[model samples]
Target: MTDSRDVVRRLREGFAWRDTPVGVFADLSGWWRDPELLRMLGPSLAGLHADASPTVVAGIETRGLVLGPLAALPLGVGFVEVRKEYRVAGEGQRDGADPMLRAGTPPGYQDGGLTLIAPRRLFRPGDRVLLVDEWIETGAQASAVRRMVDEAGADWAGVAVIVAACPPEVGERLGVKALVTDDQLPG
Candidate 1:
């Protein structure tokens, strides 16, 4: 089986690197400009799904949308999206409590006190979930998602990211294996 390092190499060959909106940072994306590259990277991300051992794949909004399902495909698991698109005055039966509105969060997004909402209740009690993202920096988002999964009595199987910039403790604190390391990311 190909290792994570090999996978990163494959990704680099298959995608284009671009700067984030901040104009001072860069990240890799599956190249829309190159079909062959997309073909390569899509499957590459999917390959991580197998390594993750997840009953379902959960992803954050925005960047996570790009990879959540792709990673789930290889694991033969369903996909879930954790987003704050709705508002709840209190903790409802299905919908979580409304996020505490922050000073700088988006208009519709509430703090949710760091709760994660799985898309359509994709996860169940004791379900093993593999969380995925394109990048993991501070790990706040992933941590919030894990808390939600745990509160629902689910198991966090592991976390896979294309780029992991945080130190090892971040994964430990979040209670997951950093399946891919910074050295394994496309450089």
Candidate 2:
């Protein structure tokens, strides 16, 4: 297995920041471009929650969509996509028959808040779900995802992320583990 420190080093090497009119933007595109980092990322994140023995991995939309599947591959589990304000046809539609579980997140570093949605059928009553994402700033989305997991009757295994920028108490409450803390980022 690759050393966790090596992984962190590689992440830092690939990561960058860009200035925009609005604010500084994190350019994580490097993470996806490196083959070795891609190979190690899933296992590294999954390792954090291996003790939890999560039966399934759940990722929020966008970046989470990529990281979630990677983590799930190493754990020998399935991946579930938690979308943002996903809409479907009426309940009569076959694909839309299963109602989606929705939860509103609190204000975060980016926007005010977002509504997370997932199909009820994807999560089983006793599933141990570990949520994965690239970064977490406010823990708002993570908390909301946990709530959705609860509403789906699934067990909250924990959260795994590339960067953890949320407050210490928030991270502890959410049972979050990360590859690096926000302060560790290069200035």
Q: Which residue pairs show collisions in model 1? A: 99-112, 100-112
Name model 1 segments beyond 4 Å from true.
Answer: 1-6, 13-23, 27-37, 40-52, 86-116, 175-187
Using lDDT as the measure, the top candidate is 2
Model 2: residue 8 alpha-carbon error in angstroms: 0.7
In order, the Cα lDDT scores of the candidates are 0.61, 0.89
Q: How accurate is candidate 1 locally (lDDT)?
A: 0.61
Residue-wise lDDT of candidate 2 within 52-113, one digit each (tens)? Answer: 99999999988899999999998999999998873432434466477878888876635677
Best by TM-score: 2
